[model samples]
Target: MLFTKGGDGKVIPRCRIKPLSAKNVVVEGRDIDVQTFLKVYRQRVHGLRFIFDKNVRRRSDLASEFEGRIVLTLKIASSGEVENVQIKLTTIAENSPFSAINEDVKESVSHWKFPKTKNGATFSFPISFYMMLPQPSMFDDSSSIKNK
Candidate 1:
């Protein structure tokens, strides 16, 4: 999801949700369809950018040593609340700093709130994290760096 800050300093979804299936409404007993569920959700959820921004620090600290991605699956209530969050995949070593980052991201996302609806929804998305060092200034030729 793309996020932009609102005038009140809240995170807002850049894109609205598209049309969704209504058949699941009857099966799930939810009043809203998938798109409606997501549209409402995207509007209310906040602090998502925080999770992505934090990755920059993680990258600087562990960039040369490791890189990783976490696939998160969330269960959202119709009331615009997060019911559950799970890490579906990760490449960080179990005891590494990236592992801690993974857990931190999951915990942060769990506390997120979505748009309320009559029925809860389940969705999966991937968040990839990595870091790199800044290159030297092009004008500084004294260091004599070779062209790769």
Candidate 2:
């Protein structure tokens, strides 16, 4: 069904619901309607947040002084498993750091869980995470010399 906005910006329901016949009846009840089906589907799909701590394990072999935000896009299945992970944005110091972080996120997010619905229906959803590079303390005199 298609919905469009009217002049006043209110949604105008545009779909014509045809009369249900006995052959078309999956379940015979007044409560069974298109709205009910839509509601059920909507309930199945959900968004989840991926929280990362300030201190992430860095790849020692890669360039050490890395800093910036890394945005990851993930597609999660209805069973709460990650189907795919993509790097939407990354500001790492080198390509190796980006690859390392990408591998780490893919491994971690795959085991993450999304909330389940009452009907037990599975749905796919996209999520993004922002990762910040760790910074050394400005109060430390040794670190200040290193920064210069």
Candidate 3:
């Protein structure tokens, strides 16, 4: 919650996310605000974080925790079906756990559906991940996440 002093000097509470607009379609990705994105883009991005976490857990042998990103270009058809998912760039190693993220993303996104458009569209976005995502063990309560 956010609070602001009213004109009468009374504090007014605001909800975490108050919709700024009713439109679901955004002309440019950056033009979409966080509040609007959560309402409109939820269907497009749901479960992606889970996929990244699942892939990262596949490999636990990192000398040190690492932070990286994987940028992808996706093309969708007029019917809203994803035509392709291409890895444009990545800062992570091209090896296990890391590479698995790309593979799974591509496969999963290949089946995603977006809002239909006149000529379809192509968009590029990034997925960032951290290695050795730390969690406290049963034997130690002080364990914490590692960062680069």
Candidate 4:
């Protein structure tokens, strides 16, 4: 019988037919089942990441040296464009180059390209960069000499 009585006493169709029509073709022209397509599409739309360069710098004025980490979180659009970029966290060295670091991050992130989703949906991800300044020797009399 094309329909059978289930435990719930409802008549359910035993056979379902999917037509191989051009209009029903999947994104990549593959004949994928509805459930599998949804699962893969969801994953692709949500998978996003940010990668930071290793040369980020941290600058501080008080310590007479620069030091810190630059944490950036980028929100990408479905079109694979960067919609927004925020500094998630900041670390500074006493004498590091803060302005230069900021500028560098801005320029670098602007050049990044995110992967686009199959359905043309955009996503966002967070990335971090670390920069540290070398510590001066404790026994170095440079600070005392400079103060004089």
Residue-level error in angstroms, candidate 1, position 130: 1.7
lDDT of 4 by residue, 1-148 (tens): 3233448743332221122232332233223333443343234321211111122211122222323454455544555565666665556443543445555555556555545544332222222223232333432456575545
lDDT for model 2 comes to 0.37
In terms of TM-score, how similar is model 3 to the real structure? 0.56
TM-score, candidate 1, is 0.56
* Cα TM-score per model: 0.56, 0.34, 0.56, 0.35
Residue pairs in clash, model 2:
none
| Ranking of candidates on TM-score, top first | 3, 1, 4, 2
Better of 2 and 3 by TM-score: 3
* Predicted structure 4: lDDT: 0.38
10 residues in a row with least lDDT, candidate 1: 12-21
In candidate 3, stretches whose alpha carbon ends up further than 4 angstroms from where it belongs are 1-41, 44-46, 61-64, 131-148
Candidate 2 deviant stretches above 4 angstroms:
1-64, 93-99, 118-148
lDDT by residue for model 2 over 89-108, one digit each (tens)? 55543444345544554466
Candidate 3 overall Cα lDDT vs. reference? 0.53
Q: For candidate 1, lDDT tens digit of each residue in 39-66? A: 6435533344354445434444444444
> What lDDT would candidate 1 get against the real structure?
0.54
Using TM-score as the yardstick, the better of models 1 and 2 is 1
